[model samples]
Target chain A: MRLADLGERSGVPLATVKYYLREGLLPPGRRVNATQAEYDESHLRRLRLVRAMIQVGRIPVATVREVLAHVDDDSLGLTVRLGAALWALPHPAGEAPGAPAEAAGPSREAADDPHRAAADLLVDELLARLGWSAARELGALSPAHRALVATLATLHRLGYPLDADDLLPYARTMEQAAAHDLDRMEQLPTPREQTEYAVASAALFEPVLLNLRRLAQCEESNRRYGL
Target chain B: MRLADLGERSGVPLATVKYYLREGLLPPGRRVNATQAEYDESHLRRLRLVRAMIQVGRIPVATVREVLAHVDDDSLGLTVRLGAALWALPHPAGEAPGAPAEAAGPSREAADDPHRAAADLLVDELLARLGWSAARELGALSPAHRALVATLATLHRLGYPLDADDLLPYARTMEQAAAHDLDRMEQLPTPREQTEYAVASAALFEPVLLNLRRLAQCEESNRRYGL
Candidate 1:
């Protein structure tokens, strides 16, 4: 099919399709002539995936390019590609050393560096692993991706000596909170209600994070003042 | 009082302090002389708040600037400012229309757009309100935040129609699923174990979403083949 037909089928505008092509997000269509190019089912699939990453994931084009490169690699699994995209979202704390190795496990050693170079690498690796894991499972969900990235970036900028190990505690906290949150969601007693609950729960996740932080802040304040 | 002293007191490096000032994230200290600026408790408080917004809230500088501006406005409650900052993280789902009339109310007549623009706005507002209430109660737990945002973004991209009337069912579902997930988490004994469970759960949320999608896909496939 021609570009117009492909656009019509995808329900995306022609201009947006052209922009995707120029951005190298879409692969070149079969050239029928100097001015015309044809698309196929693969193009449709790729376009959908691209839209998913951009609209849902809210990923920047440069990062999307990197993710696409990883995705297109035959050697890498879907999980790994997803991880790369997640990792590309933002810098995390304790990222200067052998973070990835530590995140992946003992197979990789933490090398000593006077400048904490090993620590930086470790942080980077750990984030990559976490990103990959999150992406594989949660590619359909973009807000979570943005929230995590934003949180990580904030922590990084704050000079917090964070690593995957430190993050483990926070991650655990979030998981428990989510579990509790999800439990409350299941009481609705209908399939439609269940789906609605999923959507609502997902929407509420950020504010829940904020409220939890307030709780943590209260706890911190109590500890600080010996209240 | 000097930059070095302030750095030591805040545990922030002098260079980083300079960077913060340059980024407009921090105000310059009082100029004691041509070569030195004196810092004080207010600076310390501001710095900490900045750090929290950056790290915990994951707000960007531009958004942070807006937040700071709003925070300085005494008329706005701190909770309101905080909520606004959190809301700002997710890119606008297009311009928000008028405030929603009420939760669980009937859909309003959408204006010119046949796609029910008013209804969509009403639903988004309702969801936002639901999120705000949850945040006030639950605290900002990262996993929940990510889950909710991702789900909303996905639905938005999928062109799901929503309205205020849709909220009650959605919330009811979340309350159920969250409860179910939490009950499983509590089976693990000890706070530390609970913490570990939380981390694992964070890792697991993605898988849950993926599995749900997989189930849906499988059901669709089975129906197609009469399996």
Candidate 2:
């Protein structure tokens, strides 16, 4: 098929198709003449894959080009290249703050920036502290801790700055205060209801953080005014 | 407060602080003279917010600058600007192809990029198809639709190359096959076990997509060899 035909079939514009060709994101079609080129099913497949990486993965064009280059290299597995590229892209979900069990295994460093490295360490410290606090207060491997650990692991890799050390001290302090908060939140008396409350609380962690920040600011202002 | 002091407080290094200053992600403090500068708590807060935006939000420096500018504009409500900035960043959770309830209400043309507009339409179509499939098979307000909608909204705003008319048919086909596959997997007669399976399935969506590409390639080669 010619460029127009390919564009029609792919539902992309001819100009955009030409741009992709120029960018080397799309391979050159067989030349029929100075004004014409023939594309095939492989072109269609490649186009779809490019669209998926760009649209679904939200990868930058430069990075996408590098990924395509790596995938086309016969020495590398396309699957591995694709996975690495996908991993490099920012996740669509909100960032979590700790590494998950699946991510705990040996993996190549996805980033080399020193700031990111420092941030990762901080997140690790926060998780450790949270783990310790849970063990001390709730008797070890509490369902909340388990859930948080899993969530954190996923977020940590995705690049959330949550140092376990900094967070541990803060979490310990919050844990002590939060018990009272939880008691107030759950006016019900059953263990099952409490478990549900715990689940809901886990989901509301960000909002709780926001509220805490506001309260702390208010308290500081009150103290300044001798209120 | 020297560079080292700022570094220690922020958990970022002197070198990284220098980098942030160069990138305009951090402002320089009052000069203690030509060779040194003094830092303060405001710098510490800014550094932490920068780290959060870059590491957790995965926002590029240009986008981060825009957010920072908005945040610093005192006329704007801090909470509203922060929420908008967060909304603009890619979500860390994987795309929720199953969660339609999370979908943004209606589409608006904000930017003038034709490709972006087309991509938004495509995402909407994909989500609509996914929603229809989930309603038909899994019942109303399915988790999968909610997840997909949330993911699609983020992907759409990020200028992915999806066009609604192009992806709708493909999504419908994929949803049909996925529904069949999931039905077979759920045939193991235990209601309590189904919840566990659903949770596992939700977590493995990305891995499954990764493997599906591999499976398709393998099948293609097998067919070529008459296997």
Candidate 3:
């Protein structure tokens, strides 16, 4: 299809599509002549994925690129690719990616960052208590791990005083739901397909998880406070 | 306590505390004399909440003001206060707060936003099917409602084809979790305490929900694909 048709069909503006191509977010279309290019169905699908990641997921372009790299890396196992996809999402505030590992650097300034050490220890204890094997693949400093630690710190900072044990039930609940997510993805025939599903789920479905929790909170509140 | 002591105890910098005061996110300290003000324990607590909301919750200054206002409003019921807190959190892209109701504006241009109308209808159908009374208090145009609709719409746009029926299990699981949250909060002594807990829970603990889900997903992947 022509670039115009690709934009029309994908519902993305031609200029934005061109910009994505320039940014390496979209694969280059086949050069048709000196002035034009042709996009295929795969391009349309990729464009849609890009839009989903950027527009709906609110992911930065750099993070989106990293996630796409993981999706494209055939050497990685399904679970490993899924792990990378998980880490590639936006980090919570006060937590940069690999924050704990960064604190291990030799710079004099690194030693002053106690929050990273505290968070790492907290998560280690929680994982040990939960008897979960995920830490083996996630590494101690993966963004997801740091995010959990940062959350606890925030709660404590607000005087909420959440114990690591308090997170167990919620973890178990998510594990049950995630089992369903993986069960469906595992049925796909190819690693590429599995990675695609993993990426899409990680990027696009976060709002589903969050909004569902909010809605449920509302229901619980209504029952408690209402006559 | 003095303002300096409040800043020290809260761990928020004096400059930032002053900024919150100027922004009306924190109440002014009682005047002690010329060129000085006396802040008490309440100021210290409010400063902590402000830091949590801004740093951990990533809430913008304006929304923080609105949320704090709701917390301080004695005339509002607990349910209303919670609903407002829910609305004040970051919303998913394509889901502006009160989006469903925006289409009802008198301007002829308003009715063309089909995504909003479609999302509203989808949520309405889902709420009816779930037999949840939350919609009454949440209002059809509430932020949580818009977020849910926007998520479903994003899925559709990305070619995932999620029906409102498919959201049932997620809603049920979240209800189970939220019951725990509300059960804990209801034990607090007064309406003010309840509202504070609700706001803090809504604003700060989102990372707990998101990161737990991510960690659990990793475990699910390990179980399915690991040796």
Every model's TM-score on chain B: 0.43, 0.42, 0.83
Candidate 1: segments with Cα more than 4 A from true spot: A15-24, A27-42, A51-66, A69-227, B8-38, B48-66, B69-227
Provide the interface RMSD of candidate 3 in angstroms, 1 decimal place. Answer: 2.9
Ten contiguous residues with the weakest lDDT in model 1 chain A = A90-99
**What lDDT, from 0 to 1, does candidate 3 have?**
0.71
Ranking by DockQ: 3, 1, 2
DockQ of candidate 3 compared with the true complex: 0.52
TM-score of 1: 0.44
Error of model 2, residue A132, in angstroms: 24
lDDT (Cα, tens digit) per residue for candidate 1, span A180-210 = 4345534656433333334323332333233
lDDT of 3 by residue, A1-227 (tens): 99899899887788989999999988888998999888998788788888887876678899888888887788888888878766777755432233233323222332464544455566777777777776644654566665676656545545567666666767777777787777767777878778777777777776777777788788877787872
What is the CA-based DockQ of model 1?
Answer: 0.08
lDDT of 1 at A42: 69
Model 3 C-alpha lDDT per residue in residues B1-227, reported as the tens digit of each score: 88888888876778988888998988888898998998887777777777877776667899888888888888888888777766666765432232233322322332565544555566777788888876644554566665666666556655666666556767777878898788778788877677777777777676777777778788777877882
Q: What is the C-alpha lDDT of each candidate?
A: 0.44, 0.43, 0.71
Kindly provide the TM-score of model 2 when superposed on the true structure, using C-alpha atoms.
0.33
